[model samples]
Each structure stands twice: as structure tokens, then as C-alpha cells.
Target: MNTVTRPRILVVGAGFAGVECVRRLERKLSPDEADVTLVTPFAYQLYLPLLPQVASGVLTPQSIAVSLRRSKKYRTRIIPGGAIGVDLKSKVCVIRTITDQIVNEPYDYIVLAPGSITRTFDIPGLTDHAFGMKTLAEAAYIRDHVISQLDLADASQDPVERASRLQFVVVGGGYAGTETAACLQRLTHAAVKRYPRLDPGLIKWHLIDIAPKLMPELGEKLGSSAQEILRRRGIEISLGVSIAKAGPEEVTFTDGRVIPTRTLIWTAGVVASPLIATLGAETVKGRLAVAPEMNLPGNDGVFALGDSAAVPDLAKGDGAMCPPTAQHALRQGRHVADNVIASLRGGPMRPYVHKDLGLVVDLGGTDAVSKPLGIELRGVPAQAVARGYHWSALRTNVAKTRVMTNWLLNAVAGDDFVRTGFQARKAARLKDFEYTDAYLTPEQVRAHVEGTARQE
Candidate 1:
């Protein structure tokens, strides 16, 4: 009797690209043709764009965290772990399981989509004093921390302490920083109503960025429109300036200006996943270098996408690589799956080419700005477009329903201004939340793999 061998495919990370790749693979290939395995610490794909809403109590975390196991049609075996290293020559991936067990996952083909980490600078006290807005835990902690500041300020008799507590400084004018400042500012605005003893005039929000413009991707016209909205809302906008030093109670800008504040939210930018360096391959900026089809050059059976890979933008056609965005990630996920299957079947592979759809910035409430397909829109029309795009992008029906319901509930009932006291019990800092120190070096990777092999 002759037996047929099936190919095994492994996908790392459960972000937008990873999840979409698995979904496409499950739908395209039969169970007898290949076996699919996914490596991730969490079983859910976080809708990262809505994270600011989660931070501001506009939506629950569960609503944006779409479960990977929700579909009965999903047949991929999920390894509840994070990939720490990859040996291209050995075709083996080193994964640290949630239980802290190190294991090797060998595969016929592997996809790296580990995603990005919050980018930080070397400024003094930045890592120790600032809070990040890159993950769900950080968002939740920020919400709690913000409300706690209000609670503490309300109870304080010291004028200086109260003033410091009421002042907020957000660094970064990109989409993440801008949205974060806008949403959390709205949170404080509504929250102050509950604190009758607190002076509303004392509450201040300062948004500073090293860039000359806010949301520059929105273009000059729409970007200025968004900035106007924020400025009208009393948000202090500072361009071409950044934090020179961060302290526990105050931050000094490079312009030699000092501001007193207990809260500092950092959303400056993101760097490609540290796992990219494990491959020791060519890289663009910090992302792994890959063909337009998302295949790693000179490395057979290896593919990369999402924030981890520098994929060429064939649509623009001027040697420009695709910008790291959810739009590109989602499309790249599906396209890379197709290319992988082509490789498996000895068929032709297609290159990834996509055009920019537009940009959207929701500045809390009905205030928003958007440019869809080059049509500039602001106010209520832009809000509709922004919400419409997000609603359409949600992966599951349940997530969509939950998010919509949360939006409606938040609109009708308003935020309750409650803090869960998470930051009070533990320190919430950049390093504390991101775990940047936990990643392994190349030497450590080899040692761990050899040690595990010896034990086995």
C-alpha cells in the first residue's frame, strides 16, 4: 500500500495578516492536501485601529479582539505560543509557549508576520515614566490611569499636584498619537463633569510632534482641517517639537519649554518585530526584505508580510515600498496565501500591487476628517465614512455587532468615568507593558534550541 505525505504550513503571529492568511488557506486547500498550524500567544486578532476607542471607554476590549476559534470551518492547529527564533537552514522555528516551554516547530513552509513593536527613543526617563498605546493592556491601563489621575486630583489639597494631574501631554502627531490624544481628551472632558470639585479650566491637553504637520497623510487640506478641529477643542498643538526629557511629574521639550503633568502617552511610531533580525537576512529600514510577492529572496519556503516585511509597492512604481498599514496587511495576507499555495503546487506566483484607498481620522464625537479616493471630507460626512470603513473591515459578524452596539451605547448613555485601578497596583511604563527585554538574542536562541534538543 502506498501512503501520501501532506505538506505542513506554519504561520506565526495572529495579527491582521496572519489571521487572514490562515482563513484563506483553510478555504483554499483541502485537509488532505496540507496541514496548517498557527503560532501566537493570543487566539484573537486585535482590531488595532479601534484601540483608541477601547482606551477611551467607547468600546470594550473584547469587541475588537476577534477570536480565531469562532469559526467551525477553521481547521488549522493553533500553537499557543510566540516565535522567538527561526533557523532558515534547518527549516525549524523556535517558539516559547505560553507556559514558558521552549519547543521547535518544523515545517515545509513558514510565514513570518510577527508584527511591530512600539518605537521609543533614548531620552532620559522616557521609558520609565511614559505609557504606551500599542496593545490592549496598555489601552486599558491608560484608561484606568487617566481616571485615577482625576480621582487623585479631586482628592488633593495641593494646587500644584492638582494642576499637574489635570495636565496631559501626548507625544506624536501620527494617526495613533492624534487619535489617542483626541479620544483620551474627550474622556477627560466627560469625566470632569463627574468631578464637580475639579475645575474644567484646569484640565489641559497638549499634543506635540516632531513633524511639522498633524496627520500629514490626510494631505495639507484635510490635515489642516483635522488640526483645526483639535485646536478648537482646546488641544494645544505643537509641531516640530518633542520631549527632551521626561520626569515623574514633568516633561521638558527640546524647545526648552517645561510642562507639569503626571500622564505621558507615547505613540511616536513602531519598529518591525525583533524576530526579523533572527533570520539574519537583508532588510529595508528594519523590515525583512522580500519580493513584491512577499517571498524572502534566496530563502526557499519562507514568506513574510505585514509590518515585518518590506514589500515593494508596484502600484506606485518608483521603488517605493508599501507603507505599513492595516489596508496593506489585510490584502497582503490574502495574496501571500495564494503565492504560498502556488509555490506548493509548482504554479506561477503573482506580485502584490495595491493603491491607497484613503485616510480617516476620528477626533471623538461627531468631529472627524477623511479623504476617501481623493475626495476630502470633514465633520459628520467624514465620521460616517470613517465608521463605515471600520465596520466593513471587522473580520467577524459578532465583532461587528458588538462594536456597533458599543458605539450606540456610548452615544446614548455616555462614559461612566470609572477606573479599574490597574495602574495603582502596579507600575505602568513603556518597558513594563511592551516586554521589549523578553526577546532572545541569536546566541540565546541557539543555546535554547540545543538545550531543548538535548533534553528531548
Candidate 2:
């Protein structure tokens, strides 16, 4: 082993931003310059954009999850755990490893790309009921739960229980909610063919949002087109309505309507990870406020980006911050890497600038809408653009091949509609996946680091 010491660089989270940063750092930085260490709960950088397809059985979970250890020359030290807290003054990160052991990691330079978690309101019984689509496991679990619901409903004799099992409700009108509702609806639509007893008519899907327009960012014409398509497919598209309360077997809407449903998918939106709050830094709407260069003001060695950082959108101007999208996060990662390297070499840093690439919504099968380069498209043309974008975005040849093969197989042979007993529960809430409550307070972080120091 080389005896010469180098500056220790630590990166948290393996999402788009963190992964891209690490990859760029590895390629750009020589071994003598800096040592990069990545902290994450998973070994793979999940392609989160295709999560809905995984939930709907269009693509296998492994297809989107690209492994980080793809090269034998990989030198970055990997910590398979989550950073519960960060002490900026001490330059140490408190981590909870996969085995539930707590440890302290000191760094010369640290990147905070912990990303976002599901945004849940104080609505009654939300924690007891509602499912999420933020993680791979959540997506897989949802697939199993939906399949199980169909099985249970088909095997039931009681009309009430069967009816309740057949109804599904999805909350949120953004890309996640719309795509999830659309993909899962198609899953059930194709699945009912396997069930002889369950009438396809009995299966109902309700996609509602508190926002007046569905996918408002897509502009009025495309938004209306998407709504019309969903409505024509027997899905009840309700705007300006939301869940008043969620229960084990029902969801009460804000409009005084009570619908019985065993499945409640809450994709309302996401908030910055509570991990960012451990720094006790200034934040804008729960996201860490960073300068245009994606660094904390006054904290020279620390940087934040992705969903957790409120990066100023210099390209958009007028005091607008970049939206928490994969597009922005991926680009920010590369830019932040350049900035970090610049800081290390005493070079000047440049602000992040990205041109709008537009949006794509794959509403299952040939029905879709997209705005690439400000030009609107619909039907097969839009679907082509959507899939093509996702396919091109895959990080590895193996991942791309797996995804393409899975897509082809799914298109030709179709899904078996099977459920893995991975999640052995009737209902799982958002709390089960993301450990938001597990984040340590600032005082605790200081104590933990000090305690670890004394022990060392």
C-alpha cells in the first residue's frame, strides 16, 4: 500500500448526485490528490426514474439498480450505512452501519447528497396505511401488495371485502403519482385476464390531486390530453381533491367522499432528508441553502446538492432554485465534482448552469406525453421519446441490457403477476422504509463524535 497520505473526501448517499460526483471525482482526481469514501445504505445507485415500471412489473428491480462496484480498479472506500448526523465544526459524520453499529468518520471534504424522502402530512392514519414509491424495496413491496390484493379479492366471497380490495387510490399529481397510477392501472388491467372470477369492471382506480391541473408543468394542452386519456380508460380523474384520512381499508377524501381501498399510494411530493437538518444549517423549505456553486456559505469544505440542497437556478434567474429532479441532480453532481476539485487545487469555482431538457411522462404502454426541447408530443411518438430517454440514462451496459431485455420480455410474454413474500405484512406505511425519525439531533451528534474520540 502507498504510505503517502491524501486528503480524505467523503460522500453521503448513492443516489444520482452522490454517484455522479464520486464517478467524476474518481476519473478526474489522481490517487495522490484525494481519497474518496462513499457512505450509503445500498451498494447500487438506483435509477429512480424507472421505479414505477418495477412496481408495475414492466422492469425487474435489478434492471434499474446499477452496481457501484463495477470495476476492479475501484478505489473509493464504501460504507454500507446511513449518515445519521454530520458535525461541520468537527468535520466528522456520524453513521449507522447496516449491522446497526454507530461509527464516526472524519473527512477533509464532505459532500451531502442524501436526497429526499416522502412528504407525509399530519393526516389521520397516514402512517398506519399509505404506501410509497421512493425506494426499490417500496416499489417491490407495492407490486407484491397489489398482486396480493387481487388474489385476496378473487378468493373472497363477501361482496364488501371484495369491493374494498378491488379499489385503489393514488395521491399526488406530479410525475411520480401520475406515472405510478398509470403503470399500476395497466398492471391490473392486464392482470385481470389471469383471474377468471374477478370482473374487470369491479376493479376501479382513482387518481386524485389537490392541484387543479394534473402535471401542470407539462403545459395546459398536454395536461388536458393526459387527463382525457386516463378518463377514457375508466380511471376517475379528480382534481382539487385530496385524502382527508387514510385507514386500513378505506380513504376519506377532503370532498366528504369515503372510498374503500386496501391500497393507498401516497406520492404527494418529497421533502429534503432529515439528515440535512443534523448540520443545523440554514435551509429553504427543508432543503439546505447553498450558493450557486453548490457549496455551503462560509463552510469551505462542505457541499450539498441533489434534493437536499436548494441550489440557486442561475439558468432560470429571478431568484428561482432548481427543482428536485433527476435531470438537475445528475448534472449538479458533475458540476459539484468540478467545484470540489477546484477547491482542492486552489482553482476558481463556477456556478452550476443547465439548459432545460424538458419532461417525459410514460402513462403505461403506448399512451404518453412529453415535452422535449419545448416541443410537445403525444401517443406513440411521446412513448418512444420517454423510453428512449430512460434507456439512454442507464449507467451501465449490463443495466441497459437487463432493462431492454426485461422490456422486450414483458412486451412479448407478459407478467406472471407473482408476488414475493418479501414484505410479510398486509399494510406498510412510508415510515417503514425511510428512517426519518432515526436522524440524530445536533447535540447527540456532538456527543457521539466526542464519545468516539475519547474511546479512540
Candidate 3:
């Protein structure tokens, strides 16, 4: 009897798309068919949608972090690292592990789903001073920092210092930015009551975006509704305005207004992961350009999806590419998994097609707005649908239960307004959370697998 070697399938990233793809592949393929491996820096897939809630203390960090280890149906070997580079010709991936170790992983088939980092511009002192909301650490840190600011402001005798400490600024009008501003603003609103010495009127929040409108994808009526809700809550909404320079205690806006604020939360825009560039392949913007089936054209057995790939929007046509959203990424993951299986079995691959399911924006508490299946809803009704969708989408029962329990417990008991000392009073900036400089250059990436390192 001749023994056949099973092909190695390497999936990069542990985001919504990558995790979904690995799970589907495991369920559909038998052990004899292929050996599967995953590359990620963490053991859990952080449910990104609930991160703003986590920052606001409505949800705990663990509740949003879905574990990658506990799948009963499939066992995919997990690599606790970020993929730094890939050599397509040699079929190798260079990874930098959590402990700073360089490792080479070989694969017959590769799926790139590594998500995005916060997109920033050339504003002076922006990177040095601004805080990011893209990671678990950043969210946790922001919570601590926000609480500390309230504490410091309450204790300060000087009015100028108190005003600066009490004021908060958030940039970006998209889902992430809007939710972050709303949620964190609510946190201060609720937290102010606990401090007897603090004046509630001093707590100010400013949400700004360079775009002309706030969440334009939500449509005019819904977007205007969201704006009115925030305005009613005392959040200053500034459209077509952005910071030109960021100082230690003040931010100078392009519209010539300088706001004295100690807190700057940047949830604005995002660019695809740097790993896609290592392939030396064609890319749409920063994202790798792929066929409708989510496979790199002319690159046999290599597939890409999620925020990192500009997958053609076959449903919309007219050379339109699918927007990098979780709704699309989740569907694309399962679809791509089936395509990978088809490639392995010499079967036909199908193009990924899915219409939008609508949008949801949870603004903390019972204040929410959603357009589920084209039905517009706001207030308590929208909140129900939004939370229900997120609860249902959670991969495991434990995560779902924890999230529900957190929601119920928060509603009943509320937050304690105590700083956990997770981060210091001085904020960690954008560059701290996003290690964009960590990626290996294409030449070095090629050298790793080609055994040309020693000569160089």
C-alpha cells in the first residue's frame, strides 16, 4: 500500500473571516484530506463590533474574545504569531511569534484574511499623542485613561486644567468612530454622577470627521437621525473638519479652531494589513486584488478575503469591489473555504455573491439605530435587533452567555467608576498599538525561504 502525503493548508489571521474559513474547512474535509494550520498572535478572535462597548465597561474583554481553541469538530494547529511576509513561488510564510521568534511555515494552499490597522495622516504630534481603538489593549487602556482623566479633573483646583481633562475628542464618522464616540461619551455621562466634586456640564465630547457627513452609508434620514441623537446628548458633531496639529494639551483643527482636550480617540479609517504587499502581486489600493472566487489570479491554490483582499463585487457589477465589512467578510470566508475544497478535489469553484443585510449601530444603553433588511429602527427596538444580531453571530455558547450576562449585569448594577491601572495617565499612541514597521521587506522575505540569508 502506498501512502499519500496530505496537502498542508495554511490560513493567516484569526479575525472573523479566517476563523470562519478554518472551521468550515475542518467540518467539510476529513483528516486524510489535508493538514490545516493557522497563524495569529492571539488564541481568541476578538469580536471587533463589541469593542466600543468593552471600552465603555458595558462588556468585558473576555466576552468579546472568541476562543480559537475549543472547536470540537475540527482541530486546526494554531501558530501564535503574525504573518510578516509570504513567498508565493516557494510556498512559504515568514512569521514573527509573540515571543519575537522568526519561523518559516510551509503551505500547499494559503488563505490571507489578516485584517486592518488604523489609517493615519501626517498631522504633527498626532501619532505621539492620539489613542487608538483597534486592539484589546488600546480599548482597555482608553477606559483606564478616561477614568483617570475624570479623577484628575475632579481633584484639580485650576479651571483650565479641569476643562482640558474633562474634554474628549474622537475622529472618524464610520461605524467604529461613531460608536466609540457615543459609547465613551455615555461612559463619562454615567460616570460623572459618581464623582460628587465633578461638574457634569464640564464633560464634553467632540466627534469630528473630514467627510461631509456622519455615516453616509446609513442614508440621509438614518444618518441625520443618528446625528440628532448625538447632538441631543451634548456631543459636538463636526463634519468636513480635521485636526491639523496635535499638541500635548490642545488640538488645532483645519477649520482654525483649537480645542483644549487631553483625550483624543482615533477610530477613523483603516487600511489593509501589510502582509498582502509581500506577495509582489497586483493590489487594489492596499488590498490584494482577487478574482470573484476570492483566489489570486494565476496563483494556483492561493486565496484571499476579508479586509486584506479587494474581492470583486460580482453582485453589484460595474467593476465594483466589495466593501471591507464584517458582513461581507464572514460570508466570503465560508464561500472561499468551499472554493479551497473544490480546488483540492478537482471540482468547480463558485463566485462569492451576497447582498447587504443592512447596518447596525449600538450607541450603548437603549440608544441605538439600525437598518435591518431595509426596515429602519431606532431607540429600544433597534437596540434589541442590534444586540440580538451580535449575540447570534457569536461563535460559541459561552461567549454568547457571557455577553448576555454582562449586558444584564451592567443594566442592573452599572459600572463602578474605578480605574483598573491597566494603563498610565500618559496615553499610548497609534504607533504603539499598530506595529506597521514590524513587517519584513519583500527582499528579506524572499531571502528567508530561498536560503540566501547568510550571503546577504
Candidate 4:
């Protein structure tokens, strides 16, 4: 039997939660005491709050993807893999490596922070026809898709198809949906000036939501102001409605309004990664339930945080769970780290409690809406505050510099709207993202075993 001397801590993500756990472990433990490992598909911590900017071409995609390995070399071993499942009874995790290999790793302690995937609904033709604005790839694809639509419209002779191609519809009124519509519209406005043949008046952006107000989190006054600004920009805001159906050439809304368009960006919201539900533990709103200590109930050395775990917001009464936001995720990550360190040293675990900081909505261009530290601001000052917050929130200096440089260049030279046309063929397929399942089918596994037996 192989004897292990050092304590092993396996973290199942590189996002706010996992990263925070690793950082704390490194700071608290000496090199001789423990080893920290982070398992994530990508080597970067995605700054999700600014993902809409990437989609809208306000900032390049790389600006938001801070390199995980580079930032945490002193703390943990970064494994490039997607965690598939956990054997909580054995403290083992099954991870699928980027190279398509699955391996089980044992650990003394575990932290689950797998984050989330787009929360999709059962609307007809939605998954097959709509574009998503969740990840880095999705943002890049959206930029290309938008530019390509403009290109196709500019070259097309059919007025109806051109109009259809020019029309862009975004579902959801949360930060993601609202910012996506705002930024993309700004992009189209800037780009159409370079396209002489295309009439800018023909291009339209529609923001739809089932909620009564756009950016309802911003309070009624600020939300109304934002809605008015978007409306002034020639964007349509539809409330109390959602996309009923999406097709290759058209979309039908719940309000019985049909619009012909090739673009439908779905940013309704996010749900915890399905892996959390598979843990067989109590969950709140589909997230793994965690104690105030950030530890799994009745399980020693196991913890969860971030979007994947439904940690209580004691700050809010009546058993409220923390909203899945980057700010909360970040604080939870740090708190979880502290709790883990306390557990290791036989110290008391502290309850996590953080007051709500203000939210920022970057509307692209020189317009923004923000409430920083409970102070509200709009227009260019709000835009500056929004961008400033994102800049300061980034993990590393390099990320900050890169994002600033991109902003400077964008302001000076304007948008490039250059379509890469890479993901065009793979567009319109959820299966292409490898989201449903990552493992081989039973038949395929059996066939593989048979082939191996014959070879032997």
C-alpha cells in the first residue's frame, strides 16, 4: 500500500470559490503540511461579469479570462479537466481531462465550486436555434455571428431576408440579457456607419423578459431610466413576455408577436451545474445545500460554495440563499478558504456574512447604470464606475492591463467587428458544446472492450 504523508485538498473549479479555497490554503499552510489541487476545464478564471462586453466587442475575450495556472503557481497544482462526479463516501472525484481521459483522484479534503450553466427552458426550438451568451467561446461566437449577419445583410438582394438578418432579439432582462442587448446594439450602430450600402435604420435590437421591468435589480427609478435610454437608442424593450419559439428564420414571442430574425441570444439566467444535483445531498433551488461553515452537512472534510452551492444569506432573513453573482461568489470563495483553514487547525469555523454591494451594468458606448456602495449614478460617470469596478475586481495585474489596453484601443480606433467565421458551421447546436453528456455510450464502451479483447 502506498502511504500518503501530506494532506491533499482537491478543489473542483477555478472560479471564485475554488480559487479562494486554494488561495487561503496556501496562505495558512506551510509547504510540508498540505498540497492543494484545482481541477477545471480551462486554465483561466472567467471574469463572468464582463463577458457581455466581449460578446459586444467592447473588450476582447482574453481580457476577461485570467490565467489560473499563472496566478496560482505558488498555491496549487492546476489540473486541466472537467469534474464529472464525486464519490463523497470515499472523498474521490472523477474528472474528465481535456484529452478525453477520466481519472479518479483521492483527497483528504474537497471543495466543490463548479459554478453554473445556462438555465434553459422548454420553449420550442429554443435550444436548437438560439445563441447563448454565457462563456468565452459563446461570446466570441456571438461577435462573429453578429458581424456575419451584418455582412450577409449587406450582400443580400432579398429585402425581407436582409431585414430578418439585421434584426437581433435577446431574451432575459437580467444583467446578462440587458447588457448583451445594450452592447450589441451599440456595436451595430458603430459598424453600420462603415457599411455604406446598409441602412442603419433597418437594424433592430429587441430585449424581452418576463419580468415587469428591465434591470429590476437596479430599483424602479434606475431601471426605468435604463429602459428609457435603451428605447432612445432605437432598441425595443418588451416586458412580461418571453420567446415562445425560435426558428432558423423567425421567432415567436409569448405575447403572440412574431419577428423574422436569424439572431436570438438567450441569457435568461443560470442554474447550478447539474453535477451538484447528482451529489444526492439536500439542495436549495438546485444548488447543493451547505452549512454556514461552508461545509457539507454530516460530511467531514467536504465543502461547497459559489454558484453550485446554496449557501445561506444570513444577512437576509427567512432562510434566503445567496444570489449567484460574481461579487457573492468571490466573497464566498474567500470565506470558504478561511473556514477550511480553521477546520484544518482545529479552530472554530466562522459563519459567512457579507452585505450586498452595489451592482454595475455596462451599457456599452459611454452610457452605464451603476450603484456603487449604495450611491446611484448614470450616463458616463456610471459607465466609468462600472468599468472601474470590473478593472479592480480582476485577479491579476496583467488582466487589468490587458483590459485597460483593449478599452483604450477600442475608444481610439472604434470597433473592428471583424468576423472570424470559425464557429459558423457548428452554430445552432447545443450538442456541439458537449453539454449533455461527456461519457461514451454503453454500446460504444462494450464495442471498445470487444475490440481490445480481439486485439489481445
* Local accuracy by lDDT, each model: 0.91, 0.93, 0.91, 0.84
Instruction: Report the candidate with higher TM-score, 1 versus 2.
Output: 2
> Counting only residues 3 or more apart in sequence or on different chains, how many pairs clash (N, Cα, C under 3 Å) in candidate 1?
0
Model 2 per-residue lDDT tens digits across residues 1-456: 252468889999999999999999999999878989999999999999899999999999999999988878878999999999999999999999999999899898999999999999999999779999999999999999999999999999999999999999999999999999999999999999999999999999999999999999999999999999898888898899999999888999999999999999999999999998899899999999999999999886999999999999988999999999989999999999999999999999999999779999999889999999999999999999999999998888999899999989988898779888965755566778998888999899999898888988
Clashes of each: 0, 0, 0, 0
Supply the global lDDT for candidate 3. Answer: 0.91
lDDT of 4 by residue, 234-269 (tens): 999999999888899999999899999999999898
Estimate the TM-score for candidate 4. 0.94
Task: Evaluate residue 298 in candidate 2 and report its C-alpha lDDT on the 0 to 100 scale.
Answer: 88
Candidate 3 differs from the real structure by a C-alpha RMSD in angstroms, to one decimal, of: 1.7
| lDDT for each residue of candidate 1 in 1-456, tens digit (9 for 90 to 100) | 111468889999999999999999999987787889999989999999999999999999899999988888789999998898887877889988989987899888999999999998899999999999989999989999999999999999999999999999999999999999999999999999999999999999999999998888888998888888899889999999999999999999999999999999999999999888887889999999999889998989999999989999999998998988999999999999999999999999999999989888888899999899999999999999999999999998999999999999999999978777696576768888766665777777777677777888
True-structure RMSD, every candidate: 1.5, 1.3, 1.7, 3.8
- Candidate 2 local accuracy as lDDT? 0.93
CA lDDT, candidate 2, residue 313: 92
Global CA lDDT of candidate 4, please? 0.84
User: CA shift at 385, candidate 2, in angstroms?
Assistant: 0.7
lDDT order, best first, reads 2, 1, 3, 4
Which residue pairs show collisions in model 3? none
